[model samples]
Structure formats: C-alpha cells, structure tokens
Target: MQETILNIYLVIDKGSVTSFRAKAYEMEGEDSAKIGFLKERATEDFASAFVFDSPKNKKGEYMPYKKFSKLEKQGLQYQLFEEIFEKFRVPQNPLICVTPVVDGEVFGKK
Candidate 1:
C-alpha cells in the first residue's frame, strides 16, 4: 500500500494575509470515485484558473506548470481547491495558492 501526503496551503491577501490547509488522500486508485466527485464539484464551483505550487521532482526541484494538468494529480491541491470552492465561495478568478511558503515572506505577503 502506498499513500501520498501533501502539506497544502492556500494563501489569500486582502488587507492582511490568510493561509489555510486541507488534506486529501487517494488509496492506490481504490478511492478514485471520490476524487472524481471532488473534481466535478470544483469545476461547477469555478471557471477560472487555479494556481498551484510547482510540482517537484524526486530531487525537490520545481517542475514546470505545464507538466501537470488535473489538480487531483497533486492530492493536496485537489482537496484544497474543493474545500475552498465549497466553503469560501471565492470568485471565479480566485487564486488558489498551493505553496508551503507563507505570505509576507513571498510575493503575496505583506
């Protein structure tokens, strides 16, 4: 059995800054149905782009964004996206930050 654990972060900057985390899991393809349901929910919730943390290789190097498509490919991103979409009711063009780095320390930081 294999499982992927991700530390998902969502950073939003208005006047101040905010960050959130959501955990997502898929058990060796056995739970794919749940993943699909989440994907559908996300699509119905938003019609804009989703900003994700750059995928990293085994060496911890960032990979290009084009290399990945579906959010489910990165379980954290998928779960975070769905959770935010359902809870926040963010606008269609909302930015879903998926990086471990916090705001104020990065571009969106104060």
Candidate 2:
C-alpha cells in the first residue's frame, strides 16, 4: 500500500484588520510534510497564540496525552490546529497549512 501526503499553507493578516488565506496540495510519499504555515504582517501588535495544547510533565516538559503507533504528533498537531481554526472560522482543506496571525500577544505553545 502507498501513503498520501498533504501540505497546507496559511497566510494571515492581523494588523489593523484580521484575515486569512489557505492553500493545499497532495502527494504520494512514505513520510508526511508540515501541516501549517504562518505569515504575519510587519507589526508587533499581531501575535500568534495558536499552539498544540499538550500536557506537561513535572519538569515543565511537553508530553503527549495519549499513545499511538503512528502519526501521533501529526494527529495532535491537527487537533490543536483545528481548535484554532474553528475558533477563528478558518477554512478546511486537506494537505494544507492554515496560518493565522491574530491581534495581541499571548505567549504559550505546548
């Protein structure tokens, strides 16, 4: 059996006004590629707050909440990505990265 790979790109504008653009592609390969991309306007007011909300260990290290034989990280990434997308009303597509640059600074991606 062969595997299919998907790539996504997201262009976000969080300066003065908020906007988003998305692109996707599909390919055949054994390994998958990055799922998301971020592009922000040249302004300090815009910040990226979307991140994989994973569990942390006692030592302040990030860890997966569950175990999986394959695509665990990818799954988690998608899950978190979806959460942000839904919150911001981003479009959905396979093999694409949806980058969102929002207003304000809220630092924390785990």
Candidate 3:
C-alpha cells in the first residue's frame, strides 16, 4: 500500500485501553484516521520507564514486566501501557508518536 506516516495517541480511561491513529499530516487534523493498537511492538524504547535495553545483551533488557514484549517502544505500545496505568491512578498526558507501521505498526517520527 502507500507509505503513510501515522500519528497515534494512546489513551486509557476507566480501565479500558484504546488507541487512536491519525494521519501524520492531514488537513482534517489528528482525528481524521482510525484508532487502534499495534499487537506487533517496536525495537526501541521511546520514552518509557518499563522498556530499557542494554547494547551488550539485548535479551535480558526489555519491557517492565515479562508480560510485555521487548519491542514495545520503537512501536507505540509503550505509550499505551503508560496511559493505562495512569488511568488507574489519575489519567493524564496521553502519549503520542509518528511512525510508519509495518503492515500497520509504528514509531519512526518525522
């Protein structure tokens, strides 16, 4: 398909996790595109406390819990997780990022 850059927002409300995906550069604004999650995570930790990688051994270094995938940040799953936890405490600062998805997975900001 087309190499469309997608801007995604991760929001968690009332314990329910939901993802929002919008066209990176659209006249209609950030609400023009569809909203969803990327089951397929990323290879980098974009700004997460859970995901940490050590250049030496890429195995042990990973997301917060074993439940999370190693590649959750380069992707946007990290943001999603953060939003969910925040919602549990007091939801605020929805995470966002721009990236080209893999058959629709993302995080390669422009």
- Cα RMSD of predicted structure 2: 12.1
Model 3 lDDT per residue over 1-110, tens place: 22222334322223222233332322222422322222122223223313212121265432232222334535544454443344333224332343333322344432
Clashing pairs in 1: 104-109
Off by over 4 Å in 1: 5-9, 15-17, 30-110
Q: For model 2, what is the alpha-carbon lDDT of residue 19?
A: 25
The candidate maximizing lDDT is: 1
TM-score (all chains, Cα) for each model: 0.24, 0.27, 0.23
Candidate 1, position 28, lDDT: 42
Full-model lDDT, candidate 3:
0.32
Q: What is the C-alpha lDDT of each candidate?
A: 0.39, 0.33, 0.32
Which candidate would rank higher by TM-score, 1 or 3?
1
- Give the per-residue lDDT digits (tens) of candidate 2, residues 35-68: 2211222222123323323334697654322331
Better of 2 and 3 by lDDT: 2
For model 1, what is the alpha-carbon lDDT of residue 68? 30
Runs in model 3 with CA error above 4 Å?
1-3, 26-110
The better-scoring model by lDDT among 1 and 3 is 1
Order the candidate numbers by TM-score, best to worst: 2, 1, 3
TM for candidate 3 is: 0.23
- Worst 10 contiguous positions by lDDT, candidate 1: 101-110
